[model samples]
Target: MHACARVGLDFLDSAPYRIVSTVDLAITPAQLFEVLADENSWPRWATVITKVTWTSPPPRGVGTTRTVTMRGGIAGNEEFLAWDPFERMAFRFNEVSTSSMAAFAEDYRVVPTSRGCHLTWTMALQPANLAGRIGLSLGAPVMNRLFQRFLHNLRRYTDERFSAQ
Candidate 1:
């Protein structure tokens, strides 16, 4: 059986789509976790994330709200679902503007490696409709590449910033 099927994801509407990107960086898990936890600095390191503004109180934790604007004018109203410092952080977004998917959840995990740490990002998406499913199928490759760029950007930003410190 397919892994997606084993996960109990639906066929068309909730057709489970996951994008996972991993990068090994020469930084401690705590250092990488601090960067990942700071949503305000995302735009600086992530090309697709153009802007992020907190919609809830300070100190990002579970239930925190944030408005994120990505490249090409795509925006999403997101809320923090889980926040585990130096380990993982997860979020769900809805009420997207100028996007195909209706809602999606993303999680980032930082694991300690012998050299430094390995950061992995996982995102599962749900299509809004039939048309959205078609769009997801067709756009999956491009989205994967976009996320690859995001991982590259994270690595570059961390290298440049931490190496200078």
Candidate 2:
């Protein structure tokens, strides 16, 4: 994997390309966090993700590391920037299999709601070159829809999971 430019929390706010997707889940924030913490749960909800392996041990928190394998064999080495359990979790890729990205990060925020919880997922990226920029720009619309679909998948997965238990 090639090293990606290290990005800070500020990048989530300032990245040139960002997609924010929100969904309301009929589960508490803790339940949502449980899904986030379970590596096996990722592939079940986020279709683009194939696997997740925690590089760091238990008690996940800031600076914890993980490797995520996505579709198309793309892999990312990530480090957590914020881990507030049920409320917020964010991470940035320290390295990636592709050269098209200068940086990439994601922020997941959960807020309690009357129904259950509201999740706002934000994906931020900086393209490495003109080709990358053009590709992202052209694919933005489809990507946005795909992201929202992932959240809907999450909602269904969680609903089935909790109801079964």
The most accurate candidate by lDDT is 2
**Between which residue pairs do clashes occur in model 1?**
none
How does model 1 fare in lDDT?
Answer: 0.75
42-79: candidate 1 lDDT, tens digit per residue: 98778778888889986778888888888787787776
Regions of model 2 farther than 4 Å from truth: none
TM-scores for every predicted model = 0.84, 0.99
Where is the poorest 10-residue window by lDDT in model 2? 1-10
Report the lDDT tens digits of candidate 2 across residue range 141-165. 9999999999999999999999966
Clashes of 1: 0
lDDT of 2 at 53: 99
